[model samples]
Target: MSADRVVQLRWEPRHVADDGRVELSYPGISVVSSRQGEVVDRKWVPVGEEPTFADDEALIAVLHAAWRWTRPAA
Candidate 1:
């Protein structure tokens, strides 16, 4: 059996800028999106570990998951 890894995402509202793009920040990760909600850039704190940018599909999946996770229960 394989265990699933849970990613804890923490968004910092203070870091948000006037730009159309939205910035989501976690412990050591940051995801930036375009005004239309397309991911434009991604970065890791301290740098130099993995690729800075993520695949479009992967980024979308993560954003969707995060939205669902934060949505209020009906």
Candidate 2:
């Protein structure tokens, strides 16, 4: 039998502001949540399908996600 694999997912958030933007993000995703826990902006990548990648490719995707979340609303 093949070994069932599972990847952990996590979300990080920054403090809330009157501007209604909470810096929410995951390992390979970007998201913006409101003070009311409403998701206004978000990003998700389909990594589950692959479950494997070259070292650089995996790192780059993670970096891009983080950049998107912290990016200055461009």
Candidate 3:
């Protein structure tokens, strides 16, 4: 069996508007996976909007899906 992973995410504003709508920088989503309190894996993705995940697994799944969808046709 594998240890459970926990995800941590951070968002930084790319641009701040007068109306208070901030544009998150491309690849704004930073996903960090930790196991036993030690980070194991990390990835970045341009979600294009604020993303919320219930847990690390959810975040990872969404990132992978987004990446696949955005990849150029081969």
Candidate 4:
């Protein structure tokens, strides 16, 4: 198992702008998604280390993840 603890939050696309892609992905060690009007989307398992900016090595990885996840223009 990976050293990083998976952090999952219920999916809320609105809430996902920041670290939301983590929630939108297919297998987040943790998953957070839309739960409105009594509807449930398929769940995902999220897994990743809590990124630390102070550490140069992990910082790059975190940044890349963030960059890849930006939402498209509506």
User: Pick by lDDT: which candidate is best?
Assistant: 3
Candidate 3 residue lDDT tens string, 16-72: 455667643454567666666887676665454445564445656866754443343
Model 4 bad stretches (over 4 Å): 1-54, 71-74
Which tens-of-lDDT digit does each residue in 11-70 have in candidate 4? 322224446455432323223222223322333333345534444444345444433333
Model 1: ten consecutive residues of lowest lDDT? 1-10
Highest TM-score, which number? 3
Alpha carbon deviation, residue 55, candidate 2 (Å): 0.6
RMSD of each: 13.8, 16.1, 10.7, 16.1
Report residue 60 deviation for candidate 1 (angstroms).
0.2
What TM-score does candidate 2 reach? 0.26
Cα deviation at 4, candidate 3, in Å, is 5.2
Kindly indicate the candidate among 1 and 3 with the higher TM-score. 3
All candidates' TM-scores? 0.29, 0.26, 0.39, 0.23
Evaluate residue 17 in candidate 2 and report its C-alpha lDDT on the 0 to 100 scale. 52
Worst 10-residue lDDT window, candidate 2: 1-10
lDDT of 1 at 52: 51
Query: For every model in order, what is the number of clashing pairs?
Result: 0, 0, 0, 14
Clashing pairs in 3: none
